[model samples]
Target: MKLSRLGPVGEEVPVVWEEDRAFDLRPLTADIDGAFLSSDPVAQVRVALADRRLPMVGEADALRVGAPIVRPSAVYCIGMNYAAHAAESGSAPPEHMVMFMKSPNTVVGPNDDVAVPRGSTKTDWEVELGIVIGARASYLESAADARLHIAGYVVANDLSERDWQIAVSGGQWSKGKSGPGFCPLGPALVTPDEIDASDLRLRSWVNGEPRQDSRTSDLIFGIEQIVWELSQYLILEPGDLILTGTPEGVALSGRFPYLTPGDIVELEIEGLGRQRQTVVAG
Candidate 1:
C-alpha cells in the first residue's frame, strides 16, 4: 500500500491507504516510531483507514508531504553502473561496482529546490532509480535473493560538482557528491511489485530541456546484483536507500552540458513517478 506522512498545522502524521482513502494511523500507535511501523502497522493502518470507524484526522487540512523515509541509516550509491555513462567518463566498464556514499543530511523532499553550493561551478545532475530497503540483509547468497529485501523504488537526482568530485582531494568522488541537498528523492517509494524495475525508461531535463535519457536495460550491474554485492559488505537496514546509478545523459557525460544556478532539474523513471527542483545559489 502507498504510505505517507500528513498532518494538521504543525504536526506531521503517519498515514496509510484504507478503503481508497487516506487515514491517520499515528494516533493508534502513539508511542511507536513511524519508520519502524513497516510491518502490520502499514497493514493495520490500511484496514483502519478503509473502515469508517477510524477517527478523522482533523488536522489534515494543514499537512505537508515529507520524504517518505524520515531517517535512513545510510544512503549508498553506485557510480557509473550504466555502460554508456562509463563510456562518457572515458573509462572502461568496471568489473566490480563503483560505490559511494551521500551523507544522509543531503536528502531532501523530491520537489524541494536544489541549493547550488557557493564554490560550485560544475554542478551536474544524474537521473537514477532509487532502491529502498524493506528488510535487514547481509551477505546475501545471490542476486536472485536480493529482491526479497527491497521494498520499492523512487526517482532521484544525484546532483554533483565535478571539481569537488574528481579534481580535488586526491580525486575522492564523494567529496563533491555528499554536499547538502545533493540527493533529491521521492515522488514516492513504489513497492517493487507495483512496477517493472528492469525495463523502465529513465530521463532528466534541465530547465525544460532533455539531458540524460536511457533505460534500465543499459545498467551494467542491475538492481538485484548491486544489492547482492552491497550486502556482502555493508548491512542493509530497513529504510536504507541505494541509488542504482544514472544513465548516459548526465552533464558529466559531456554530450550536452553542466548545470548553473537558476536551472530547474526534472527527472523521472517510468512507474516511479517524477521529480522537479530548481537550482539556486547557496
Candidate 2:
C-alpha cells in the first residue's frame, strides 16, 4: 500500500493512493494524526487499507503532499555513494561511508518551491532514494537483517548551497545542507513489499533536460549496508530517514551548474513515484 500526507503544512492528513484516487485515512484513525509514513505506518496502513468500507478521495481535492515522514528523528545522508557520481565529484571511492545530517526542519512536501537562499549562487539539486526506518535497529551484523528494518522508500531532493557547504563552516558539509526548505520529499511512501528498492531506475531533470540518471545497481553501498553501519553509531528510531545518496549528473558533478530562480527540477525513483519542484530566489 502507498501512503502519503496531504493538505497544508502542519495540517496534513494521512492518505492512501490507489488507482489514481486517494483514500482519506485521516478520519479513520489517529495513527495518521501526524505523519504516518514512517516505520510503523507500513503495517498500520496495510490493515487500514484492507478495510472495504473506507472512503476514497478524488483527484481534484485541494490537498498538499507533505514529506513522506513528518518527523524524522534525524535526516541522515551518505556522500558520494554512487561510484560514477564519486568520480564526477573528483573524489576516489571512500574506504568507509561518508555521512552528514540535514536538519529535520528542512523537510517539506514534494512539489513545493525550492528556495534559493538570498545572496546564494551555488544552489544545486540531488536526486536521492530515501529510506524510512520501520523499526528500532542498532548494531546489525549483516545486510540481510538490515533489509527487514526498512519500512519503505521515498524520493528526496538534497538541495545544496556549495559556498556555504564547502567554503564556509570550516569544511563541515551540514552548514550548506541544513537550510530551511533544503529537503523536499515524497509524493508517496511506497512500502518495501510493493517495490524493490534495491533495483530501481532513478533520474533527475533540471528545467527540461536530464541531469542525474542512473540505476540503483550503481550504488557503491546498498541500503542494507548503510542502515547496518548507521545503527552502530546512532539509535535508528521509528521515524528516522536516511538519504542513500544521489547518482552522477548533479549540478556539482562538474562545472557546478547550479539552480537559479525560475528553474524547475523533477525527479523519480521507479515504483516509489515522482516529485517536482520549482526554484525561487529567497
Candidate 3:
C-alpha cells in the first residue's frame, strides 16, 4: 500500500493512495508519524479499506504532496554505500560502514523549492532510496533481522554543498548537508510488500539534463546491512529516516556543473516515486 500526506506544509492531512485515487485517512489518525506507524498502520489501513471506511478526500493531482511522514526523530545517512560513488570521490570501499546525520529540519516536500545556500556555488545533488523504520531496532543480530524492522521506502534527494562538506567544515559532511530544505523526500511512502528495496533503480537530473543514473544493485552495503550495522550503535526508532546513499554519477564527480539558482532538479526511484524541485537563491 502507498501512503502519503497532502495539503500545505504543516497543515497536511494523512492519506492513502489506491487505484490512482487519494483517500483521506484523517478519520483513522491525525497524522502519519512514528506513533501511527507503531500501531501497525499498514494493517490498520488494510482493515479500513476493506470496510470502506476511508473517505474520498480529493484528487491526487489536486492536492499538494507533502513528505510522506511527519518529522522523524532523526535522519541518518550512509556515506559512499555505493562502490562506484566511493571510487568517484577518490576513496576505496571502506572496511566498515561510514555513517552521517542530516538535521531533521532539512526535510521538505518532494516538490518544494530548494534554496541554494547564500554565496554558495558548489551545491550538488544525490538521488537515494530512503528507509522508514516501523519498529525500534537495537543491536540487531543479523541483516535478515534488520529487514523485519523496515516499514517502507521513499525517494530522497540528498542535496549537498561541497565546500562546506569537505574543504571548509573540517571534514564533517553534515555541515554541507544540513542546509534547510536539503532533504526533499517522497511522492509517497510504499510498504515493503509493494516493492523490492534491494534492486531498484534510482536517478537524478538537473535542468533536464541527466547527472546521475544508477541502481541500488550497485550498493556496497545494501539496505539490510545498513540497518543492521546502524542498529549496533544507535536505536532505530519508528519514523526514523535512513538515506542509503547514492550511486556514481553526481556533480561532485566533476562530470557536470554544480546546481545554480533557477535550476530544476528531478529525482526518481522505480516503484517508489519521483520528485522535482526548483533551485532558488537563499
Q: Whole-model Cα lDDT per candidate?
A: 0.77, 0.82, 0.91
1-282, model 1: which lDDT tens digit per residue?
555555422354656543345566555654223245345344555566566556655555345555556657798999989888888888899899999988987877677788888888888999999888877889999999998888777788888988898889475688899888898877566676558888899998988988878899888998899999999998998788899888887777677667777888899888777888988888
Off by over 4 Å in 2: 31-43, 60-62
For residue 24, give model 3's deviation from the true position in Å: 0.8
Q: Order the candidates by lDDT, highest first — what do you get?
A: 3, 2, 1
> What's each prediction's TM-score?
0.88, 0.93, 0.98
Better of 1 and 2 by TM-score: 2
Over the full model, what C-alpha lDDT does candidate 2 score relative to the true structure? 0.82
Residue pairs in steric clash, candidate 2?
A: 7-64, 39-134
Of the two candidates 2 and 3, the one with more favorable lDDT, higher being better, is: 3
Please list the Cα RMSD from the true structure of every candidate, rounded to 1 decimal place.
3.0, 2.1, 0.9
**Compared with the true structure, what per-residue lDDT tens digits does model 2 show for residues 1-282?**
787888778877778777688877765554332234342665665576786545787662477788766777789999989988888878998889999999999889889999999888889899999988877788888878988787788899998888898888696899999877999998888887788888899999988898878988778888899999999998887678899988888777664478989999999988878888999879
- Lowest summed lDDT across 10 adjacent residues in model 1 is found at 31-40
Range of the 10 consecutive residues with the lowest summed lDDT in candidate 3 = 56-65
Candidate with the greatest TM-score versus the true structure: 3
Worst 10 residues of 2 by lDDT: 30-39
Number of the candidate with higher lDDT, 1 or 3:
3
lDDT of 3 by residue, 1-282 (tens): 999999999999899988788889987999989888878888999999889999988566888889999989999999988888999999998888889999998989999999999978899999999999998999999999987889899999999999999999887789999998999999899999899888998888888888788888888888999999999999999999999999988888988889888899999999999999999999
